[model samples]
Target: MSCVFLALKIGKVNWQPKLNKAAHHTSDYCSTEVILRRGQPFNISLNLKTTTQSWDNFTFIASTGPSPAESQQTKAIFSLSEEGASGWSATQEPSEPRCLSFTILSPADAVIGRYKLQLQVLAGNKSSSKVLGQFVLLFNPWCPGMF
Candidate 1:
């Protein structure tokens, strides 16, 4: 139900390897490359440090598909409070990583491509979105061999 992916990437970068915030995700490798099967939810988790008082208003928007909502690769807003528990809400902490979980779904003919992650936190009446990290969706190699 709840898995962690820390292998993806945090923020943007070209082919070159630049240092940035270490993205905490459900994947163990990083936040760039992920292998999944068709028609299944690739469970993932990410930890984002925040100073907000409440995690209820925190949300994350991830774009795994090149196309918008039509490509079956699009994702909706994932609430950190709804997914996992962040000490920020329970206790008045300065800043802590809000652990959130979500699933990335690939279609039957899913093309191996890049998926980006963006985190959004809402406080009072204001909201903000930021590019947190990214990951690659690869075809599952355990698929039944064709005859």
Candidate 2:
């Protein structure tokens, strides 16, 4: 059996949603990657700064494969922040960094080879993407104790 892991980080501490003429806004988003040993658990942290009472609807997508165009063997999406507004909504202030993490269950018959993991961030309908932040996996079939 083999395992996978992922980690994430944004480039800046202060981020504001870009507003359109009607004042509709969309925040900037980013992603990171992590590698893990088979059967191990992993964690990821997300940080943001905003004046809104609360940031809501932040989204994340996770996929595994050799490339983006190829089929992903596994995938998932979830929210990164809670709802409600903070007291600093009227001023420019940095919010505390938050972390979101999940575990991967390696396939019972995982093959020994290089695999790819991709993470994408979506704000409303817009999409921002990132690749592996960690090293690639190398599976060895010739190790001792192998049949």
Candidate 3:
């Protein structure tokens, strides 16, 4: 399931952040921040530096909302690594950045908010494309609003 959410607006109301576990293939994965009334849950991670090519097949799909031509209900839930031959690689040369971490789930009622975290990177075809970056989901308004 591909679901990325981070909405904050305090003073009015609008907060959404939930993505409890991520990191399947390789690159990098870290996104955790789901604390409505406790603590711990705020670590969004995703790093990539591609240029390597040749390709037998290397897939990395991650989506939440928007993009994908502008959302069609948004769907990007992919996790595959451990195929074979060092996770399959052809070699175009240009590797040095790879990280992915995700963990977010704030549900207790959640209210006092502000968020908008989006990340994308799908290189399955199309001669290989890239666009990995997106962030925004702050918390700490005295923290304590799960309702």
lDDT of each: 0.42, 0.31, 0.30
Off by over 4 Å in 1: 1-52, 65-67, 81-112, 141-147
- Which residue runs of candidate 3 sit more than 4 Å off their true CA positions? 1-38, 51-97, 100-111, 117-147
For candidate 2, write residues 1-147 as lDDT tens digits. 011111234433211112211121112223221223332222332342222223333444434454532134343343443322211011112434342332223322333334443345444555545542432222324323334
Residue 143 C-alpha lDDT in model 3: 36
TM-score of each: 0.42, 0.35, 0.19
State residue 103's C-alpha deviation in candidate 1, in Å.
9.6
Off by over 4 Å in 2: 1-9, 12-35, 46-96, 138-147
Top candidate when judged by TM-score against the true structure: 1
Instruction: For candidate 3, write residues 1-147 as lDDT tens digits.
Output: 111111111121112233322211211334343323212243444343322222333333423444442134233333333322221111122323343443333322222233333333333333333333333223334334422
Error of 1 at 92 (Å): 16
Error of 2 at 110 (Å): 3.1
Instruction: Estimate, for each residue in 19-115, the C-alpha lDDT of model 1 and write its tens digit.
Output: 1112222244554444334433444444544221334555556566657462364554455432223211111223224544444344445445666
Error of 2 at 108 (Å): 3.2
As a TM-score, model 2 comes out at: 0.35
TM-score of 3: 0.19
| Clash totals, every prediction | 15, 9, 35
Ranking by lDDT: 1, 2, 3
